[model samples]
Target chain A: MKYVDEFRDPAKAKALVKEIAALREMITPHHQTPLQLMEFCGGHTHTIFRYGIEQLLPDWIELVHGPGCPVCVLPMGRVDDCVALAERPDVLFTTFGDAMRVPGSKKSLLQAKAEGADVRMVYSPLDALQLAKKHPDRQVIFFALGFETTMPSTALTVLQAEREGIENFSLFCNHITTVPTIKAILDSPDMRIDGFLAPGHVSMVVGEQPFRFVAEHYRRPIVITGFEPLDILQSIWMLLQQMADGRCEVENQYARVVPSRGNSPGLDAIAQVFELREFFEWRGLGSIDHSGVRMRPAYAPFDAEKKFAVPKLRITDPKSCQCGEVLKGSIRPWQCKVFGNACTPESAMGALMVSSEGACAAYYNFGDLQELLQRREKEAIPA
Target chain B: MCLGIPGQVVELIDSEQMMAQVDVAGVKRPVNIACIVDEHHPPEACIGDWVLVHVGFAMSRIDAGEAARTLAILAELGDLQEEQAAMHEGAR
Candidate 1:
């Protein structure tokens, strides 16, 4: 906890909060609207809500939770495809624990397992590979999902499978890129984000270079942020300081873990195994070009998409779900029609309600539900 | 999951596979150190290095100097805030 406990020091957080409030005063007069800073990673959102960071901040500073949770953004069609693959008689489906509860069009992977599918929760891709090794007669498919932070691990696992001549193991690759999604968010006409807190772990693999475009092209001050409460507060302080100085630049608040140049071996493995798809569909954000990756031709033997026959269907989100608006920061989670009433974590109506890192789920689990609902009700009534 | 925890490299499990046993708090797990190891700093040199482990892989080596530097800056900021508060008291 050496790295963690130091970053969570309440005394330091209080000092940082005081500085942020002063910075807010300097920043507010320049713009008529409140300073909308989006923390583009779900991990940051989790930390923010869990620590009640939003309550501590001045009202003039609004923290818009962006769509950085990979699990939360996973399209329902993909979940259906996962179910189709899992329900297959010969396939032994393995996925991360969080992915199990994500609701598909018909049923989630958990439901599929309940109805009798060989679905297993794995800690790592290597564990899936071990399943392949153990069950020679069965096909082991690892549900590969996440952004660049997890891409290298799956890529390396594929390589390991090849090296060991394990022909039965494959990856259902759903790895996404961070930069394209950020670009999509900036390109939106309604996006009023003054700055950003970029995902830290993604930057650790991809480095600080990929985020330079946000500063140069979009003219937004983005600080690559850590997940701890202090890291987030310090990063916000850095962004506000930039605004106070009338500057737009990509800064690093999590420099201890993130290098300027990313992990070479990880990048090499990723380059060797995966190629960018033309476009990938997100649950709430729709399709963004070159946002997702698939296994290269050389790794087709280890590609589950290539090896297995999936439904490959396009399933739309429910009509009442305002996950799109919530994801875009156009509305708060509580403002969604089905938020706490119909989309509790126990029975999630949208992908955001399924994952702990998700904005809706975080709000539900950590935020005072009664207070949020009452505030929403008050806003709804005419003055 | 995108969360990466900082753990210290305890022992080398497999040099060829660039594998090492990393201790996170009290739990021990085998993690691949392929990303952190290279020609100059080989697998053997990573025995006592702290790394950010993400999903069975050591993605990056956590720099102690950088960590100390970040903390130092935060400390300085705290001192500056205290100084400003004292100045405000004097003015009042």
Candidate 2:
């Protein structure tokens, strides 16, 4: 907690908040619309809502939660494919605990486990490899899904498996790139995000270079942010400072863990093992080009998609689910019609309601539900 | 799933494998130091380095100097705010 506690100092957060409040005046004169600052990672969204960062800031600045949660953005069809792989008699499907409750077309991985699929929750891909080592007869397939932050670990695990000649272990690769997704968001017609709080951990792997387009091409100020309350506050202050000065740049506020050039070894491993798929489907956001990664041809033996026959079908989201709008930052989670009612975390209709890092789930868990609902109702009433 | 915790490398479990035992909040776990290890800072040299451990791997080394600098800046901001408040009070 050495790095964490210092970043979470209340006094420091208070000081930063005071600075941000003063910038609101400098910024308000230039822009009449409420400054839309999208925290592009679900981790940031979790921190924002947990600390009531939205309420703490002035009304002129809006923190729009973007679709950065890998688990929440996992397509329903992919979950069905995971179930298909898990249900196979000779296969043992291992996945992260966060992905257990994500609803597929038929059921989630948890429901499949209950119905006696050989599915297990693992802390790491290496753990899945261990299971493969332990059971020679069983095929251990890791349901690998995440942003660049997790890609290195999966890539390394695959490399380690190949070194040990572990033929039975494979990866159901759902690894995604952050840059393309951010591009997709920026390219959207309704994109009103004035600035961004980029993901910190992803920046640790891919570096600050990938984010330059946000600053240069889109002309938006971006700060690579950490998860702590004060890190977030300071990052907001940094973005505000850029806006007040009329500058658009990719700045690093989480330099303690992130290097400007990124981790070369991790990048090497990723390059060695994975290749970008032409396009990949997101749960709410449709297919974006080069957004997801798959094992390269050389690593096909370790690719679950090649080893197994899956449904490979596209299943649409439920009609009542407003996850797409929420993901696009067009509507808040409370504004979704099914939110807190049909889309409760207990029984989530949308993937966003499944993961704690998800905007909807964070809102559901941390936000005062009744207060938000009453406010929504008040806004709904005609004058 | 993107959660990366800062931990200090306590011991080299395997040099060839680039595995190190990292202590996070007093609880130690073996993490792969492949990303952080190099010719300059090899596995053996990473024993005392702080790293951001994500899913059984040390993805990046947390720079102690940068951490200190960030804290110092935040502290300075707090001091500046206090001075401004004192000045405003005097004017009133």
Candidate 3:
């Protein structure tokens, strides 16, 4: 906890809060729209709500959550495809713990398992490969997802599987790139974002170079942030400083973990095994071109998409759910019609309510007493 | 969901496989060091060195000096009287 405990020091947090309070003077009349700052990663959103960090900040600065949670962005059709793969008699579908709870078009992977499917939760893709090794007769398919932070390990697992001659192991790749997705968000006509706190873990793999467009093209300051409380506070302070100084640049607040040049071997592995898909559908964001990655042609033998016949149909989100607005930072999660009443975490009607890193679920699970009370008060008012 | 935590390397389980036992918050578990261990870098994880372990893999080595520097920057704007008291105590 050496790196973590220091970031959570209450005394330091208070000092940072004082510094942030002083930043209110920097927001002049030119900074219209209430200094809307987007924490572009779900991890930052989680940390912000978990430590009651918003309560410490001045009301002038609004921290909006972006669509960075991979699970939250996974469309219903993809979940149905995952279920299709999982239900196959010859296949053993392996996925992460949180993904098991994500509802598909019909049911979740957990429900699929209950219906006698060979679906298992794995911590790593390598664990799924071990399953293939243990049961040579079964086709082990690892459900791979996330940004650059997780792409390297999945690529490496594929390389390892091939090296070990594990023919039965394959990958159900849903890996997406963060840069294109961010660009898509920035290009949207309704975008009113002033600054950004970029995803730290993705920066660790892809480096700071990919985020330069945010500063150079869109003219928004971005500070790559860590998951800890102090890291987030400091990053916000950095973003505010850039805004005050009239400088738009991609700065690194989590430099200790994220190198400016990125991880070389991880990049090499990703390049060797995967290539960008022309377009991919996000749960709420629709289809963004070149925002996703699939196994390269050479690795077709290891691609689950090629091995299995999934339901490749696209399913629309529920009518009452306004996840698109929440994901675009246009509306708060509670402002949606079905927020607490119909889309509570216990019975989520949207992807945003399913994942812990998701904006709605994070707000529901970690909001401080005062915030929760305010939300409940709003819930009392009819939609 | 990249929830990587800092963990101290306790032992190397398989050198060829690049697997190591890491102690994270007093819980020991095996984590792969493949991503961090490059041909140029090699496996630099000693028994006590800390690494950021994410989903059963060590993503990167945590620099102790960098960690201290970040902590120092955060604590710099703290109460002046407490800083003075701490300085005075250190003088003893």
Candidate 4:
């Protein structure tokens, strides 16, 4: 709690807020365009919205969420695949807490569980292995979902499972690439971003190098920031300063962990175990070319897709769900139609509301997010 | 996708698979390295030595130059307050 609690100190957070407020005050009120800084991480999005970081900001500054939430942007078909796995007899689906409620082809893991499937939510991939050990007769498939931050844990789980000869366990890999997804956003004509609040965790693994491609090509300065309130506020200030000065380069404000080269061992482990597919389908993002990793041939025995077959599913996002637009940063959460009415934390219409880290869900449960969503119901044009 | 952090290897727990604790400003989390490629924490890795951890594996040992540079930057940020306070006093 030492490092964690100190950063959460309200006094320290307020001081940072004061600093950010001062930074905004210096800029003249009359401006051509409001500076829109794209936060390319879900953590930053949740932190900013949850803590009302915007409340502390000057009106000209705006924060746009990016494709950082692994759950929010996961295409419906993958969730449908997970639901199919959960529905199979003798198959135990192990996943993080957030994926349980994510809607998949008219059903979710939670719904599958209700219809008599063994769905267990775990905090780590190690937990899935433990579940497999406890239930030897059942096939335990860990819903391996995350960015580079979580891939090593998933990779290690397989290695350990293979080493121990655990035959009943496998993994459904949904780990994604932060840089390429960010590239997809930058490449989109809709990107009016002046700067970016880059992901803090991803930077630690791939290091500060991958982001250079983004900075160089997009010509948008990115400040890689941490998960806490102060980390986000500081990043916003740094981003604003960069935009004000017209600088486009990557800076590590979260240098306590991330570096230029990153952890080569982690990279090597993933390389040993997994390979990138030429293209994979993300529900909202469609088929992003080579955006995901799959198990290598060496680890085929442990690959969930190879080991087990879930019924091919025809899935669709709810007609009312505006998750696609929200993820694209075309519209904020409040701009979505089914935000609070059709999509509560308990009954989410899309992956955004179902994921614990998803901007909308993070707002709903942790940050009084439902109120804003409800407000949107009245504001949205009647369809 | 890199979300690796540097942690100090406390011990070679679990036989050939070393188990170590990673600290970031006194934040410590236990990580497994069976998946990472360090039969022995490279020559640079040792007890009380900082190694970069990703997904539960100690991937590589932290470089001294970069470590020093990070510490120096934090130090400079820490020094900013006193420097600014002194400047204000001189103005008064």
DockQ winner: 2
Candidate 1's residue-wise lDDT over A1-383, tens digit each?
A: 02222445768888888899887568888854678999989878877876678877888888888889999999999999999999899999998877998989889999999999999887677778878999999999999999999999999989989999999999999999999999999998878888999999998888888999999988899999986678899999999999999899999998878787878889999999999999999988889999999999999999989998877889888889988788777888999988999989988888789888889988898788999999999999999
- Residue ranges of candidate 1 with Cα displaced over 4 Å: A1-7, B63-92
Please write out the lDDT profile of model 2 over residues A1-383, one tens digit for every residue. 12222445667767777889988778988875688888988878866765678877888888888888999889999999999999999999999877888888889999999999999877677778888999999999999989999999999999999999999999999999999999999998877888999999899999999999999999999999987678888999999999999999999999877889999999999999999999999887889999999999999999998988877979988888888788777888899988888888888888689787788888888878999888888888899
Clashes of each: 0, 0, 0, 10
Question: Compared with the true structure, what per-residue lDDT tens digits does model 4 show for residues A185-258?
Answer: 77777666667888877777678888897678878788888655677878877876765566778999988666
Residue A44 error for model 4, in Å?
2.0
Per-residue lDDT for A232-303 in model 3, tens only?
889889988887888999999988899899888889999999999999998878899999999998999999
Error of 3 at B6 (Å): 2.0
Count backbone overlaps in model 3. 0
Worst 10 residues of 3 chain A by lDDT: A1-10
Record all residue pairs in model 2 with backbone atoms less than 3 Å apart, i.e. clashing: none
Tens digits of per-residue lDDT for model 3, B1-92: 36666667888888777778877545566778877886665665456677776667788878766434433443432322332232223222
Local distance difference test, each candidate: 0.84, 0.83, 0.81, 0.69
- Candidate 3 vs 4: which has more DockQ: 3
- Ignoring the other chain, what TM-score does chain B have in each prediction? 0.68, 0.68, 0.61, 0.49
After superposition, candidate 4 runs with Cα above 4 Å error: A1-32, A131-136, A362-383, B1-12, B20-30, B34-92
DockQ per candidate, 2 decimals: 0.25, 0.28, 0.17, 0.12
Which ranges in model 2 have alpha carbons more than 4 Å from their true place? A1-7, B63-92
Task: Order the candidate numbers by DockQ, best to worst.
Answer: 2, 1, 3, 4
